[model samples]
Target: EPEVTQTPSHQVTQMGQEVILRCVPISNHLYFYWYRQILGQKVEFLVSFYNNEISEKSEIFDDQFSVERPDGSNFTLKIRSTKLEDSAMYFCASSAGGVHEQFFGPGTRLTVL
Candidate 1:
């Protein structure tokens, strides 16, 4: 079965540098989303994209963050300037439709120091 794939499973960056997390969802999936989990916190939804546009976003997705599908197969999340608080395991997910069920990637662990 096809699954979501994320590059650079782990990343280390400076606090103020930019970072782009990449993910390729299952080819047949329609909706894509980004979620993050802080060390001891619950999973938090960041944003969702569909039909080439943002369908929904949480307060965490602010002016400093952006999502894009540069190509039909790749979905990307860009954080303009990293912060110590931004360090977490970011997961990329996709579902066939609506919010019924979502398949998640292995997650990219980002460390900002």
Candidate 2:
């Protein structure tokens, strides 16, 4: 079955450096989203994208964070400057449409020091 795939399973970076996390979601899904889970916290939504535009974003997704689909098959999240709090497991997910089950990627573990 098709599933989302993220690159660089683990990333270690300095507190102020920029980082770009990449993901490739299922081909037929129409909605894409980025989410993060701090160490022991529950998953938090960051942003949602559709039709090449941001459909909605959470307060957690501040000016420093951005998402884009450079092409048909890839989705990406960029953090202009990393903060210690930004260290978490970032996941990429997609759903076919409303009420459909979302498929999530294994996740990219980002570590900031």
- Best candidate (score: TM-score): 1
Which residue pairs show collisions in model 1?
none
- lDDT per residue (tens digit) for residues 39-103 in model 1: 99999999999999999999999999999999989999999999999999999999997666999
lDDT by residue for model 2 (1-113), tens: 89899997999999999999999999999899999999999999999998899999999999999999999999999999999999999999998877457889999999999
TM-score for every candidate vs. truth? 0.97, 0.97
Off by over 4 Å in 2: none
Q: Indicate which candidate wins on lDDT.
A: 1
The Cα RMSD in angstroms, rounded to one decimal, for candidate 1 relative to the true structure is 0.8
lDDT of 1: 0.96
Q: Each candidate: RMSD to true structure?
A: 0.8, 0.8
